[model samples]
Target: MKKLLIILLVLTGTTAIKAQTRTADESAIEKTWARFGNSWRNQNFSDMKDYMTPDCHWINVVGMHWRNLKEVQFAHQAFITAFLKDAKAVDKSSNLRFLTNDVAIMYRVTHIGAFYPPDGIDHGTNKQGDKDNIATIVFVRQNGKWLIASGHNSDVVAQAAASDPVLHMNK
Candidate 1:
């Protein structure tokens, strides 16, 4: 019994150590997201590039796919200049999961202040005067830095009747 207890303690200690290490990685990823949010609000895609991989790909909420860092930067710059110049971005929440020591995925919800749409109408915001989007991002640890490898953003919209859990739960 004493030998078994010692082995269990060692296993528990190893698990604790791994959890601590994962927590640190989670914190680092959160910091990176905060920096990216700041860059977005400031309309500084150049600064945002620092957090992304060179071949990073992004799909915007509207389904536009940017194939590389340069394309992403250029697309954001043009859109911000045209419509979101005065917009504000706030990170609502982030959920991170590690696939491996060097690969992670983050699901982030962001609130964007009211802005003019591409149609020249002030219709970007929702009823709360903020547009909320959920983004799924893939990150890779490269050279001790967490950089975005790819991501896709989608607008959070109201649930339709088909999506109502109460209506489908009985069925």
Candidate 2:
């Protein structure tokens, strides 16, 4: 009878240890999402794929969509070229949660440095373009690493501010 009691206690202890370990792994996955946000803002695509699955899907409010890692990387490169042309990059990430051991979600906010057009072009040339926005990343754990399986972005457009500058410039 005593032996049976000892065995039960050992089982309970082992289960608790596993639960704690799983929690830690989940937290690490969330941190990976945060790191991805930082890398994207800095235009470090080289390491970006490490956080995403090869088959990840991405989309933005402009209707731009990417289905594979290659496309996703290229899309990001385009964004970096169009904007942040000599500007500092900054980002904030948070709101990470796991729906299951293999699935998670997080949000990020990025700020692009001051933008200026070519020497002859006006600074307000692209004022009508999109600005600061929010991105939601969904991750899935496969094998041993957490990968971003899907992403969605909702761009922030300061319609009032944008229209005013453009209209005033034409005046």
Candidate 3:
């Protein structure tokens, strides 16, 4: 019985060490996201590049896909120029877990306060409200640092009932 107890204690100690190590990884990834959000709100998008991989991919809430860093930059720049007059972003992450020693997946709900234009540009958007959305990002650890590899975003949609014609339309 004493031998069994010793073995169990050793196993528990090993598990504790792993959990503590992964918590550090989680903190690092979370800090990366914090930097990204700060850059976004400040309209200092150039700073965000450092947190993303060279080949990072992003899917915006509007279903537009950015396949590369340059594409993502262009998209964000356009949005910042045209729509984002003044805004701030707050994100809460949950279910953040490491998929492997070098990868993590987390669900984030981002609440953005976006000031809208009087008339939206070519995309035909006029109505604007507080934009809140859920997003998932995969962070990959490379060279002992975390960087965003890919992200998918889905807006928290609000509309009328299905029976209403307005339901199918963007408000």
Error of 2 at 50 (Å): 1.9
CA error at residue 119 for candidate 1, angstroms = 8.0
Structural RMSD, model 2: 8.9
In candidate 3, which residue pairs clash?
Answer: none
Q: Which stretches of candidate 3 lie over 4 Å from their true place?
A: 1-6, 117-125, 158-171
Candidate 3, residues 1-171, lDDT tens digits: the string is 999999999999999999999889989998998877777767767866788888999998778899888887777767765676465667754679778899998899877765565423435565454777788898999888899999988876655234667757887
Q: Write the per-residue lDDT of candidate 1 for residues 1-171, one digit (tens) a residue.
A: 999999999999999999998888898888887777776777777886789888999999879999989998898878777667777777788788899999999999888776777733566462232678889999898999988899898878755537867976765
- Candidate 1 TM-score over all chains jointly: 0.82
State every prediction's TM-score relative to the real structure. 0.82, 0.66, 0.79
Best by the lDDT measure: 1
lDDT of 3 at 12: 100
Stretch of 10 with least lDDT, candidate 3: 118-127
User: For candidate 2, lDDT tens digit of each residue in 134-155?
Assistant: 7788889888888888899775
Root-mean-square deviation of every model: 3.4, 8.9, 6.0
Worst 10 residues of 1 by lDDT: 120-129
Number of clashes in model 2? 0
